[model samples]
Target: MLPYKNEGEIRRLEGLADQNKLTNEQRTELTKLRNERKAHEIQVAALFDKDTAKLHSELEKIDLKASKPMTVSTTEPI
Candidate 1:
């Protein structure tokens, strides 16, 4: 299942589990759902880290370009 779908289902199950007593099976299911959600969260965080590194590299290139001095050419008869 997609991460968002797993997140929604996890929330729903948590609400239900909080409201009433869970049977052994339901408790086991809840534990599995929680682990799945945590795994997805870790995957998402890794993706974010990759994106952030790419952005930082691009920003550094821009800064280097901005910091360089410009040259001016003069063509005139003297």
Candidate 2:
């Protein structure tokens, strides 16, 4: 899916493509938009992957803390 910021551009391109005729400039701009969208997708995917790894690391730490035994101390009054 196109990013929110590019939704308008995607709509415009869809309208242009639906017309079945494009000016040279329109075609060039369409190609540029497609490349930009592809680059955005790759960047977003990388960010998501990084975030997932970070979350997994955090979860592992939580699990380790939960598995460790806790200690309690009791003392008698002198």
Candidate 3:
């Protein structure tokens, strides 16, 4: 939920992660922060978009991997 709101803590945690030293709870929190940050960025980018689906497709293609895929969706009525 933090989503880099605590910049110092995020950096410290990331340093630990790079050293493979995160506790289970720290790892979970870091994962959540990264996800929330990514979602926030995507939403901001979508605000000026003319084609939401095209944006989603482009992002998916940019970050998607054979072993891991990311999904972005909206339920607003068109």
**Which digits, one per residue and each the tens of the lDDT, describe model 3 over residues 1-78?**
223465667788899999999999999988887777777767766664747778888888766553364445333455
Per-residue lDDT value at 77 in model 1: 41
Name the regions of candidate 3 deviating beyond 4 angstroms: 1-4, 50-78
Better of 1 and 3 by lDDT: 1
Best by TM-score: 2
Instruction: Supply the TM-score for candidate 2.
Output: 0.77
- A best-first ranking of the candidates according to their TM-score comes to 2, 1, 3
RMSD of 1: 7.3
lDDT ranking, high to low: 2, 1, 3
Q: Estimate TM-scores for all models.
A: 0.69, 0.77, 0.50
Scored against the true structure, residue 44 in model 2 reaches a CA lDDT of: 88
